[model samples]
Target: MTAPEPYAPAPQPAADDGPTSLVRAAIWVAIGALIAAALVCVVWVLIGGQNGIVGRAFLTILLLVGFAGATILDAHLAPRRPAWFALASMGVWIATLLIGAVMIWLPERYSWGGFSRFVQFLFIVLILQLVLLHVRLYLKAFQRYDTTFTRAVAIVTIILVVALAALLIVPLMLGEYLWFPDIYWRVTVAVAILAAVGTAIIPLVNVLFAPKKPRAAAPYPTPYAVAPVAPQLAAPSAPVADPASVAAPQELLPWPTYVDGATPLPMLPDGSPDWGAYYTGYPTPGAHVFGAPEPTAPQTDAAHPASSGYEGFPPPPPLPPRP
Candidate 1:
């Protein structure tokens, strides 16, 4: 049989469809949401939405965007795409889109007592999310495009983004560049414009310049290189495992079948079994599979030569004179 290859390619991972039930998880979600709402309500009651109608409008938008971001994060990081998190995240996205649209288009009508400057920030976030979603849906590493096509896409994106950036700011530019004279307002406008252009350019730049083919991961370094297989034969019969070597079992002797503490009774020098004390000593002697010999001392034999008599186990207490 042929030797096996050094490594087999790892299997590709499939997306998890995830569990069907989210009902069990809904209670925890509800509790968390309630706690958050209570905290926010308390803070707003004390501090109020950053003061003023414009400030309040901004605060409302900020809150919406923040909540949307958190939900999106939950969806992304949640284990196994659990139904509760997924549905909750989608619901948040929908709410954000709706509220953001209302605030952007009709700031005066639906504007709550929240900070106002945040409306444009929400717009920027919406644009970024949409662009990200597009990349995920359409970008394919396996599919290749002509260089000209990619360059065109990148250019068109850049132009559209620049136009949107202008349109997003032009209305506020009326009067003296901005309604609110605060330096922060100016900073917000600049940040929004930068974000818009960046959001457009980065993703397209990757599409245009990045290699379309998926880069194969470098094979892990191995101590030995495999001999190249010939293409002529269609996989010479799959390799068989080498037969394992094991030692044969040894046979056991019968007469001395080992059992815990199964022993013959002790003997006196006169060659008689000392049954009285021996029986007392052996309270729980184990019985061997092959019976032990009679308690007589060893007879003349090669296994146990006759004993040249010796003192008793404890020498029988100094002969206990005169007693």
Candidate 2:
């Protein structure tokens, strides 16, 4: 019979947890921001509003677009549906608007400027949250890809985030004590621009250097071919001997089939002792003794006929008894 083939282990599926979608979203957001900036300039010219109004509107829209783009990217990259990112962003925006209105109404009704501090605090918290969120997303991407480029990018992003945080917090601290620095706004604007540029560039670089997918291996063969049949010869039947012409079969000596410390002989399919195996195995009597005498027939004696009967001998002199 033919032997069976060896078994091979199955290959595992690749993980689908990369930030490709986020990278694409960031690219789109950058393009949209550029377009929005141009449109804002046109609107400012047409409405002829105060320069402050245009500046504030442009900055607010830019921040909103950045946050919205990030939210969309996160939702697309996430494993599940329902886009929790979109929902969270919407909730935060609505809450901020409502709180700002309440703060404005309270200050006007009670003639208190302290309520303005609350509005500033809320804005600071929101900015901090957005910064943290971006940092977290970038860190996650770095971990997932685990490449040299990604590591460098992650480090750069983290450093920029730290610098931006310092710029923002330092100004706020100074403002709280009524000691605003002359270059505070300039430093803040410079850091913000640098961070935004870096954020936009990171995704583009990641997408460019992303790993390619491996091709699938060929499958094993099905329904293995059947083993070829061997031709068998039929055993010949033994001829029956004539009763009167045939001589009687000789009887074999009654010797031990097994010896001490020897293994039992194996049998054939027909349940007969395999003599070929027996001869090839254990040694026979007198096999090791050189010039050993062959077995002789037993001597016969007239007084002990029974002892000589095995050799078909007539009686002869018997052996004397021991003293």
Candidate 3:
């Protein structure tokens, strides 16, 4: 019987392929609009936002920008991202826009100065939060397409935007008074510009000072060891004198232990301390002889024959024969 073919999974579509040209063009258009809107806000701030209408105008413009950014973000990420992810981000965006708009409208309709001050602060906070969140999202999502130049530009732009937003703290403190001092405004602007320019050069610094990879050491050249010619040893020459001369003593060395060292020497039947059975003569060398004064030539003397040779002392007297 023929074997069955293995199962194969169906290929899922790519993220880029999921969006049509029209949708992509729309995304680009939205991106361009966001850029243009940012430029307009910068221009407005530069052109002396000291007018009495600054409160209403800036808030309105900012809220509209946030709404557009949030909407575009929903479209940009939804196709690629999971449903829950899209829903969560988009929901927060819309919520911020709605709350800000309602807050703005309530103060205007009621003409409450104290309430307006509160709403103004609330409004500033909301706008700043939305701006920071959206910028973070945009930058993070587009990292795959980032270049060195684009990254540097983004860093500089972020610094400028944050610095500009900081100027609002002064306006917020003034609260419905509509009085922004010229020196403070000029100082804030100059600082923002200088910071943006200075911060932008960090990418260049990274390029210049990046850590270098360490070099691999060359494998130390191993010289082939010259095997010594073993001196062509002359057959070791029969070890000079005789086989009897270098032969080990017939009694092998004793087994070693601490007790063995402390034990008294074994006595011979004749009551001498036996040095070893193989010892040649009584009083083996330094010992004085007993039967005969001199160590009588290691001879087989009938009565006291050369047998168990004591190391030093002469053997004690033999026991009397049994009756």
Give the candidate number with the greatest lDDT.
3
Candidate 2: give the clashing pairs: 301-315, 301-316, 302-315, 302-316
lDDT of 3 by residue, 30-139 (tens): 56655555565555556644543567566757777767867676786767865544544555454445445444433332346536656675767665665556456545
User: Which residue pairs show backbone clashes in model 3?
Assistant: none
Off by over 4 Å in 3: 2-69, 72-160, 166-177, 206-323
- The residue ranges of model 1 lying beyond 4 angstroms of the native Cα positions read 1-30, 35-180, 213-323
| Stretches of candidate 2 exceeding 4 Å from the true structure | 1-111, 173-176, 212-323
Strongest candidate by TM-score: 2
What is the descending TM-score order? 2, 3, 1
Give a tens-digit lDDT track for model 2, residues 1-323.
96755675667898876444544454455456545544654565567544345444554455456546654655564445233444444344433333332232221223344445455746665666686678767665565457776677678867887688767754443344456666877877887887777676667666777565799998654322211211111245387676678775444322213222133333334333334433333234323211213423333456755345446764332221112
Worst 10 residues of 1 by lDDT: 314-323
**Candidate 1: tens digits of C-alpha lDDT, residues 1-323:** 98877797878899885434463354345346645654554455466533354544455556656665665465545556545445554544444444443333332422341234355555655654564444333333212443565556545544554455444444432322335446655765665575455445545656767656678998554432122321121267554465355454243222111122333333334333334433233212332111234333312445533342234333211110111
Model 3 TM-score, all chains together: 0.26
Report the candidate with higher lDDT, 1 versus 2: 2
Q: Rate the local accuracy (lDDT) of all candidates.
A: 0.43, 0.49, 0.51
TM-score of each: 0.24, 0.32, 0.26
